[model samples]
Target: MRPTRAKITDAISAIERCFLRNQDGTNSVKDSTDSLSITEMTELLESLRGSIQRAVSVEQTRKPEFDIFLLTFQRWLLTDIARDQALLCDLLLPILNEALPPSASITPQTAPFVEKTLQFVRDTILRCSVAKDLIGKHMIGRLVATAVCVHASTMLKRQALDILNSLLAKSKENKALLTSHTCLTDLDNLVHLLKNAGDVELQTQLVELLFRICPKPKQERLQFIDTLHLPKIFADIRGDYFHQDCRAFLNQLNAGNDGVLKTPKSFRLSHAECVLGDTTSSLTLNPPDGADSLWLDFNTSSLSILVMIAGGDILSIELAFSKVQRWQVESSAGAFLPMTPIRI
Candidate 1:
């Protein structure tokens, strides 16, 4: 049913009142002493969400009044409210994902707003199933592009990569979208980020993302690695969490079936016949101490590869390919030895 203008006005008024102050100068929705209990607060938030949804639905048809209402609501989310970040994320995720798609009228004036909303979406998607489900094909490329925007904050960029990691875990279509030429600019930014990432976590995630984007088709995968320019990118990065994997990625590109293992004494060459499916290649290497044998498993999926070492205790270090890397093994020296490939 079409809502009358009076009904729309009432909805707008209800939303506006969420940020309004009482005669005592206390906030109506956020302050407890103003006679708003937790249940009342939740009910009020639900009412405001409905009003915002209605305004968003109306704005789709070029309704100016609802557009104004949306602008006002965005302002409230940005300023008027403080503790309801979850609500803000829930409110903005769908609007950004469904309403303001890549074709939306995002001028310089609105770009900050769009980016901020994406940051919220990035933070929410990890814990909120609804936000995770909102990620579709239309949003995937944009999110990748957003992650590498030169002006984007490190927090936003990392969150964007994190969100991509989650989506890449869910389906191959997301991985395909990332590998396509449409993300050329994104990949460029990714290379830039890889070289310049002061944030260790950010750089680690970048490598994992690159692994995820490795195209499964043999010809395309070779072309994609060439497009990555891994050697040039790796030259600047050293002594980082992804050093060995970066070497392995480069070796895989340069020599299809052989890998290089570096020791203080000499460099040893190892071979593994590159496989034909999603699981691209696996290599096992022996460390100098002969304490543990390292196993490296590479996959084309977004979650990327897992590096495991076997000795007295089985140790697993999952690359940021998924979530957090697991490190459960320690050395007799009383230090936590990171579970990395010996050299492959």
Candidate 2:
């Protein structure tokens, strides 16, 4: 016989009881979590995650059981129940995707849940390498989309960017897997999203994201960079003191100032002196101040910066280089000033 609403309610209540916080204040999921064997845990996880996926399909996000389901899966993760196995990764991916689907309407109430859900996943991955790599393989695109989704909540965008930053930093594996033309499109999309955003902190976060996902061997960057043409937008925002870091990031990606230069004024002079018959000798780039220059301290050479013809209102920041088309500049410049810009 088909299950009645009463039976389903009872089943849901029972699962909810397993995950709810205790009045005693200990980790509530601990006792119930301790009771499951690997096989039983796996089966329960599949069931819970599947229920969530089904709820998402029906647009039932308003229901309380939607949260109950996520709580159950999240509680299972809080324990050592499945520790980095592909099975756990596999189960979690669908639940996460359902939580923040690329094409979902995000109302204020639903938005926080999505943002918090992403934060939970990010925190979980931070604790396990196997989980990090596994999720990176399949979730990179979705995460990028989340970070750049124009209509999505800012908290969601920032949180998704944080997770991407960590995964991309872990090693060459994630860098190679994530830095592709497909992924670059999302970066471009984010740039467009923030083109008119007045929120300085959000703009700063996007700059941070750019530093994180910037591809290596910039020759491989065209598929992404070429598609992003925001010269006018960048030019408009460059004058704002709050936008200096964002301008610096674009200057590096577009102008090749990915740090490493010692003195901005002198560097410009030397650069000008080197070029024979340069028409833009008159073209001025207002570089950063001598005491505090805008420099990018990338952690790896595996990370590459795109060759953008940087042209915002800032003089030294703007560059007129030869038409190399898509030249790559890899930076390993350490010992740089700490700078912060906002998001994608």
Candidate 3:
């Protein structure tokens, strides 16, 4: 049922009165949270989410103030109301949609907005099964892009990398999304990030993500190592790479025919290969068919070769080619490692 204008107005008024109070000339997060019931909070969040999304869709000349509302709303969602999983799922994605500006670049001034986004992913989005695959994981490309955005503050980049690491620790669904075709299409961008990341910790996180999603196929894995061209970086990080968990990760990758770090074979151009990226959306600033960047992606279990064209007057395009090719990927029958999904 459509909400009557009066009903919407009353809900908005109630939300303001409930959440925007200054007692003793100070605003208390606790008081604000306690003022509304879960149901009321859900309703208010939906209403707020709708308004923000409409503003974004319409590309209003004036940017909406959803960012301010989101920071406050997210705090209560993460802490005071953490146990309400349903409300978190219902409200978190829309909050994210509100936080991200359609055409705005991720930069230093965008730190707080990105940080709140990380907090949402850590506390709710990553662990919330309902949001993990279909809704939450889609943030991967955007966050990865932020980690490499030249204009982003070092602080934002580090936090963005940390959020990527956190996403991997949540579940297989999270890990799978990291390797899925939509994400694999962003391989070129990830390549840029891996090469340019200056911070030691940030570099480590990027390396881990890269290796974690290294294609299951031997040839593609070799292609990744060759393309990345950072041969000695990982080897020189002796003390850090030897950590128990890192060692375990390394061991698993090297255990069988699936060894991702194995020496590269000749770079043979093949139709059936995988590259993880989001070129279709990322290359919108340029012109249509501007760059015929060729690569392959695993759209789930299926394989596709794509040439990305950056849109000029129109939006970007992802072109898939039909050609027959085959590469044998060895299936690992090894026992799975003990699971410890951590988030911070």
**Model 2 off-target regions past 4 Å?**
1-9, 15-34, 215-344
Candidate 1 lDDT over residue span 1-344, tens digit each: 55566676676565555554557665443433333333444444454444444433423433344354444444344332234545534544445553332433344444545554565555443444443334645467667666666656667677678777777775677776666677677788777776555443465677777766665566665567577766534333333545455545343333432212111111112211122223535323333244332333332221122233444343433343333223233333445434322222
Cα lDDT of model 3 by residue, 255-341, tens digit: 332111121111111222222243322211211243422222222123323333444221212222222122322112322222111
Please identify which of the two predictions, 2 or 3, would achieve the higher lDDT against the true structure. 2
Task: Compose the digit string of candidate 2's lDDT tens values, residues 112-223.
Answer: 5577567667766466436566777867777777776667766677777777777777556677766555566666676765443333335556665555554544443443
lDDT ranking from best candidate downward: 2, 1, 3
Better candidate by TM-score, 2 or 3: 2
As for candidate 1, its clashing pairs are none
| Candidate 1 accuracy as TM-score | 0.41
- What is residue 285's positional error in candidate 3, in angstroms? 47
For all predictions, the C-alpha RMSD in Å is 15.9, 14.3, 18.4
Q: What does the lDDT read for residue 138 in candidate 2?
A: 68
